[model samples]
Target: MTIVATSTSAFYERSRANMKDLRLKAESLQAQVGSGEKLSRSSDDPVAAARLRTLSRLEKLATIDTSNADRASADLSLADSAMSNMSTAIIRAQELATQAASTTLTDDQRAGIATELDEIQKDLLALANSRDSNGHALFGGESSGNAYEFDASGNATYIGTGNSQSLPIGDGQTMDSSMTGPQIFEFTDANGNTTDVMATIKALSEALKGGSTDPTGSANDALASLKSGLDTLSTAQTVVGTRLAWLDTVAERNTNLSELRANEKSDLGGVDMTEAIASLQETLTILQASQASFTKLAGLSLFNNLS
Candidate 1:
């Protein structure tokens, strides 16, 4: 008969290894419970970790898109307000022109109207050069300076770019932040000639101040041009309103997408506290039983039995 003998040291070593393994498993579960995360490291679940990384990147991009959308909305709102005030000023100018066109008004009255028109021109220029929320030109079309500038002869000229800047909101969507100065102020008159609100007001004021052969003729001529400029401003306001509406839609969509991403992240990475705690308790119970068994077995020996 063949006999196999196991050394006491080998038995102790095997028991220690088994206890160590249980201890390690208990510790891992505890860490998971405390940290509230399923995977402690990427290697724990590489696929889930990679998906989490992608979700994090998308969240960052969504944040940027939200910021840009907010800025664009602000600038567009400012432009809309400025245009509303400008429209009011233009309507007032038209009324003043109608008064000046009447032959019953005295020279002094016409001069008084001219003074008010000059003030209105300055107001228009200020509105055209209005600043945005960031203190930059609102109608300058991405330029840093004013949208309009006056020459030595008091002629107002548009110095802004031809087109405004377009900002990306999200999901491959983009919108113009604001309209250019010329888009709001300049248009084709009834005579098929290009004219602007500021220039028309300045010319009318000059004529009323004796710069023209016939002041009433000049006032009548400016009415058509002023009306055309107001139409252009109104059209621009509609465009801005449409863009703001679109931004609102994009914001809602982005919010939904953000919520979805958060849910996905929670599903992939978040630990279930109830399950983790139950598993940890079960593991600890097994470890304790094994430890007690080892303690009793280790104390048992042939010498003790003989004693």
Candidate 2:
């Protein structure tokens, strides 16, 4: 039977290609074992690579969420402290009203108390216009300036937007970071009258200075208004405190989720050094055997044993 002609050049070419492929595979395993990563390119395992990419994206998002949570918590904490101080100021005003309402104090003494109350009013206004960590007005509600502004009449008017500031703390979760100035300082009393604490204190101060015919009655009214303001401040503090607690819960959940994602990423892309090393050893043995066979075959040329 006539044998089909097989070119020596073709044999050499095929053997070189096979040997190169085996060497590349062996090197790849070695790299995996050294670097502790499964693949250097997405082409090696597209599914795993895609999953890893998604995990990376989520990790970045979680970091951002955590920062937002921290900012919101801090802002709310400042708000609580400020409200607590406001409550204390109102309580002091209440005490002064009780003392001033007594018939024992002279007009001069009542005016002195009013002067101090005016100073407290100034303090309250400053507190209402307090700035946050970012230098924006804490109660401004998207406004960069003071939350409450004084008119030409020296009447305090809320210039801030009525909406409260809110922040995203996690997936599908958002929290109000601040309350409006009006909501904290201007609350309706049981008599259905809108009570402005600043104005009430100012009115009380003026009444004590003999602006009202019935100074004792005005003091009693002021005392009642101050009590309402205390309630408003306490409610605001409660709201802020509740939000802070929610943020803490969200923060914990985010941390746990981040850890879970990291573990999954490790499982998907991390290399098993022991398995890679064993595979590299097997690949090297196969390459060596193939090289020896090729070398022996290459030595047997058509002209080697020709007569």
Candidate 3:
């Protein structure tokens, strides 16, 4: 018969190693239960960890897109309101121009109308230079200052950029936040001339105040240009409305994407609390049984039993 001899130290060492491994596994499962996360480190599940990182980056980008969309919506709304007010001012000016074109009006009444028209011009200039949510020029096309600057002669000139700024709202899409001052105010007149609302109003005000050879004739001529300016403003309002609608659509899409990302993140990284707790309990019970068995075996000596 062949007899195999094992050292007591080796037996104890093996028992301790097995118990330590079981303890570590139990602790890991407990951590997952408490933390509600399946991964303690990237090494736990490299593929899932990498995917989680990607999702986190995408969520951050979605947040930025939401901010940009909000800003664009605000600026567009402000532009719409300002344009509506401009249309109102233009309609009032049209009525005054009709009154001034009458031959029955005296020179004094014409002068009064000119003064009112000048006030309206100032109002229009103020609207053109309206500030955006960030306190920058609303219609200045990314310029920091006013859209129009007045000179010594009080004639307004466009000092803003020709094109409005485009902002990214997400999903690889971009939208213009606002329209430039010239876009809403300038149009081709009846004389085949490029003219703006401010210029038309200024010229009429001057003519009504005796700056022209014939006041009634000048008022009659301005009617066509004013009508053109109003039409231009209406077109701009429509454009703004369309952009706002597009933003709403993009917002809804972004919201759905956000929800999808959240669900994916939960599935990839979130721990199932019930399963984790049950596993932890089972591991603890086995660990306890192993520990008690090891203690009992370590205390049992062949020499003591023989004695």
Candidate 4:
């Protein structure tokens, strides 16, 4: 009888271990389904676990790079639009100068065009002071407020700092936070004339209406100056386009890399549901058998056999 009890106790202990294992396996399957991961600990598969950790870190960095790309693209777009507007302003000034050049129009008509140019100048100044989504100057590099400081003499001066702040876009890649006010809207071209579009507009307006006669060569010179301003604006447009295209490539690469990282992470921790189910069923059967055998043996009596 003692032997029978000892054998039964051993069987019971074994059954208990098997049942615990089955419970653990079932829990693991449940976790895999719910959490969408195959392993919860390093003991599950150390190599895969390490790979998953690495991929997760890279994926997070890629996500941040994506955000930077979006912001940079927006800044470039704003600059491009502003440049286009400056070009339109210059074209209008050119037309006005041509009309005023005719010996036919009354001084009143010329003054009228000048008045319109003055309004256009105000509008152009407003554009030069345009802000980005973050409320920073779009053209003034990194200025927080208006980029142009128009003096009492109507001279528009750049009050912004030198370089814009930068955003980290990728591995060893960075984008200028924005173009500075001076870089985009302030400058002197190859000609002695200032290319400050707003300042030019103001000067032309004053020249037209300052009660001066068709100051013989002034209108022609103004047109030439306006053309120079357009050239500067056109060059800026080219730069913006190039930056935007480069950002597009960077954004595409970042997107592809991010997707690759996510895939790698899944591969590292993903489960095979078909295989897991098969293994779980097998473990359940073994545990059931072990429990049944342990129960039967625990009920056996050595006295019966002895008799």
Top TM-score model: 3
lDDT of 1 by residue, 1-307 (tens): 1111345666678999988998998999999898888888999999999999999999999999999999999999999999999999999999999999987888889999999999999999999999987888899988889999888888988888877888888888888899998888889887788889988998899889888888998999888888888899999999999999989999899999999999999899988899989999999999999999989987888524533
lDDT of 1: 0.89
Give one digit per residue, the lDDT tens place, for model 3 in 164-203: 9889998789999999999999999887889899899999
lDDT of 4 at 177: 52
- Identify the candidate with maximal lDDT: 3
Candidate 1 ranges with C-alpha deviation above 4 Å: 1-14, 301-307
Q: What are the runs in model 2 whose C-alpha is more than 4 Å off?
A: 1-15, 30-36, 277-307
What is the lDDT, from 0 to 100, of the residue 306 in candidate 1? 39
- Cα lDDT, all candidates: 0.89, 0.86, 0.92, 0.75
Q: Write the per-residue lDDT of candidate 2 for residues 156-193, one digit (tens) a residue.
A: 78898878777777787888788888878887866898
- Those runs of model 3 whose alpha carbons end farther than 4 Å from true positions after fitting are 1-11, 301-307
Would you give me the overall lDDT of model 2? 0.86
Q: Indicate whether candidate 1 or candidate 4 has the larger TM-score.
A: 1
Instruction: Name the weakest run of 10 consecutive residues (lDDT summed) in model 2.
Output: 1-10
- Model 4 global lDDT (CA atoms, 0 to 1): 0.75
| Clashing residue pairs in candidate 3 (N, C-alpha, C atoms within 3 angstroms) | none
**Order of the predicted models by TM-score, top scorer first:** 3, 1, 4, 2
Clash counts per candidate, in order, are 0, 0, 0, 5
TM value for model 2: 0.86
